[model samples]
Target: MVIKAQALAYFVVKCTFSGPQDLTLDEQLIRTPGIWKLFVDGSVAGKKCGAGLILSSPEGFEICQAIIFDFPLTNNETEYEVLLAGMKLARSLEAKHLRAFSNSMLVVKHFSGEYEQMDPQTTAYATKIKDASLSFGTFELSQIGRENNGWADALSRLASAKTQSLTGSIYLTEAKTPSIEKKECLEIRQGADWMTPLRNYLEKDILPPNRREELKIKYRASRSIIINGRMYHRSFSQPLLRCLNTEEQYQALEAVHEGICGEHLAGWSLAFKILRQGFFWPTLKVDASEYAKKCVQCQLFATVPRQPPEEMTSVLSPIQFAMWAVDIVGVLPTSTKQARYCIIAIDYMTKWVEARPLSAITEEAAKKFFIEQIILRFGIPKICISNNGTQFNGNKFRKFLHHFGFK
Candidate 1:
C-alpha cells in the first residue's frame, strides 16, 4: 500500500510539471481555431473615466481601441461599458465565436449570471450585452488577474488620463455619453387643452381674438399664476395647488386612490386626499368617483350596509333621567393609570352621558359605577338597560340592584 501511494504521488507530480503538450481542457478549448479573443478594461481617475478594448483575431491580427468618456461613470460601469464596446467591435468584424477576458470579477460574474446586477445602470448594461450577444454564434466571458490584462489596463489608464501622445497603432475615440443611454426620437405634437389658454394668458398675454373668449381667458388667468413655467391654481384653502393635464390627472387619481398608501377610500375622501396631496384638476371629484367605482378589488370586498329594508323605529323616553342605557366601551389602549375598560351611562331623554375608566370590569366594579355615577349624580333611573354582559348581569350585581329597588 505504501509503494502504491508513493507511485500515485509521483505520477500526479509528473503530470503537474508536464510540458505545453499536456495542456488542460480549458486551455486547449480557448486556443481553438476561428475563436476571437477580446480583452477589456476600464479605469476611473478622479473625474475622468475611460475604457480600453483589445480584440485579437484567430489569425493573430490585433485591434486596440481606447475610449474616453464624457460622462462620469463608476468602476463597474466602466468595465461593462468597455466590454460592450468590445463585443460591438467583434460583431462588426464578423467574429463567429468570441471569448472575452476582464480583470473585473464583478463584470465577468454578472455577465455569466454568477452575480446579480443589483444596480440599475449595471443591470441595463448587462441586459444590453446579453441582447447583443445574439449577434455572435458563441460567447464566453472569463475573469483574469490584473497582471494578465496589462495591455488593456494600460490603454484604459491612458484614455482616462487623456494623454496627448499615444502610439499610432492604437485607435482613439471619445464617447459623449454612456452606451446605454436611450436615443430614440420622440415626436411631440401640441394640441389645444385647458391649460394652454390659461398658460398663454398668464405667460405671453395671448388670448383668443373674440371678445367673449378674451374676457373668459382674462378672468380665468386672473385666478391662475405661472411659477417656473408651470401653471398653478390660486386656491382659497391652500396656498397653491398644482394643476394637472388630462394624462397627469389620471395618473394622480390612480396613484392616490389605489397606490401603495391608498386605503381604497370613497370617492369624496379620495378626492379630498388628492387635494391634500397638492394636486388639482377641474374634474378631480368626478374622476376619483369614477375610478373608485371601477376598482374591482373595492367592489368585490366592499362592506354591505346592514340597514333594514323598511324603516328604523325610534326609541323614546317619557322624561329626562327616567331611563338610562349602560354599556362598557373598552379593552382599549391602556392609559397611564393602567385602566383599559370604560363604563358609560346615557340618559335616553336629555342624552346626558356619564363615564368612568376602570382597570378591570367586574360585577363589583359595575355596581359601584352605577351607584356613584348614575343614582348619586342624576338621581335613580326608572329603568336601567344593559347588554346582558357577565359583569352587568352577574348574581352580585343583580342582588345589589335588587337592594336598591331597581326593577
Candidate 2:
C-alpha cells in the first residue's frame, strides 16, 4: 500500500523547520559532525507513499540513496517498510559508523528495541533492518522531532518525484519595490581580446568538446555571439570553459563564484562577474599580498562592516570564587521615593545572580545595600565587577568596603 501522493503534499508543509535556533539537542548532535549524516524522510504521493535518503558530509552532498518503490497499496506502515529500502542502500557507503535520527518514534523505537511491533508488516521491516544494520558497521538509532528532520524530508519528496518520473515543479517569486533610482552594479568589461586567448587554447589544443562547450557557455554565449549561420545561446559552456583554462585561476574563480556569487545571485542572473582576463598571473600562486588584492569582490563586499566596540564581555569562565560579571538594569518606572536604584550581582562560576532595589545609588547606599543583601548572603565573591562608573568609584564606597575588610 502506498501513501505517496497524500504524504508528499503533507510532507511539503509539515517538514519545514524554523531554523537552527529551534532545533533540539538530539537533532543538533546529528547535524554537527563534519562527516556523513544520512537523513531519511517519507512523504505521501497520491495513494503511493515515497521515502527519501540524503547523504551529507565534508566530502560534499548527494541525494538518491533510494526513493519510492511501489508497495502494496495501504497505509503509512507500508510507506515506512519501503523507506527502509534507503537504509539498505546506505550500507553501500560502508561508513565507519552510522547515526540514524528520525522523527518517526515508531520506527526509532522499534529499531532501538524500545517498542515491539504490533503489526506483522512492520515486524518484517524491523527484522530486515536488524539484519541490515549488522551487515554494515556499528549503528545507533535515535528519535528526533519532525521539525528538525526538514532537510531529509525535502530530499525524500524530491527523490520520489524523480523515481516516479512525476512532473513536480518548484517556483520562486520575487517582487521588487519600484526604486526611484535603480542600483548600479560594477560589471566585468570583456572585450574582443578576452576571447582570443580562450579561442587559441580551445582550437589549438586537443580540448574535449564537453570542456570547450562548458567554458564557452559559461564565459561567452549569454549576450550575443555570431556563428556561421544561426544565433544560439551557450550559457553553461562559457563559465565552465573559464574554469578549465588555468587550474589555479579556476580554483580561485570557483571559490569566489561559489562563495560570494552564489549568495547574492537570486534566480537565474548572476550578481557578480568573474572576467577571465581580470584574474592576474601572480593571483593564481600563493604570494603574500597580491593574492589578497586579487579578489575585487571581497575588497568591495567581504569586509566586515565596522561596529562600535561592544560593552566588553568577560570570557573568564565561571569559577567558584575567582571572577564576576556585574551589571545594573534600572530607571524603573515602578521606583518610588522608597527605592530609586537596583543593585545586581552575579557569580562568574555558578551563574548565580543577585538583585536588589535600592532607595538611592549613593556610596553609602551602595555599601549598605551590598553588605546586607549580598556580602552576608554569599560571603565575599572575591572579585567584584562593575562598569567604570561614578557609583562604584566613589570615595565613601572605597572606605565602606575597606571598613568591611574587602579590597
Which candidate should be chosen as best, given TM-score against the real structure? 1
Alpha carbon deviation, residue 162, candidate 2 (Å): 12
Backbone clashes under 3 angstroms, per model? 0, 36
Q: How well does each candidate superpose onto the true structure, as a TM-score?
A: 0.39, 0.32
Give one digit per residue, the lDDT tens place, for model 2 in 1-407. 12333232221212222322355655455565544555666666664454555554434444333344344333445345434554544554445566665677788888878887888767766776786677555677666677776655654564245333322232222212211111121112223233434444444543336976767644543433323211222343343222222445446445544554344321112212333333332123333134344556646777575775876665675457445555666767666667756878776777777777876676776677678767777676556678956777788877766766655
Deviation in Å, model 2, residue 115 alpha carbon: 1.6
**lDDT for residue 317 in candidate 2, whole number 0-100:** 54
Please, what are the lDDT tens digits per residue for candidate 1 over residues 91-189? 857798999988899988888899977889888988888988877889988887777676677667754342333333322234776777742211122
Off by over 4 Å in 2: 1-22, 26-28, 31-35, 58-60, 64-66, 73-75, 158-407
Misplaced by over 4 Å in model 1 are 1-27, 160-166, 170-172, 182-407
Q: What's the true lDDT of residue 177 in model 2?
A: 20
TM-score of 2: 0.32
lDDT of each: 0.76, 0.51
Residue 111 in model 2: lDDT: 83
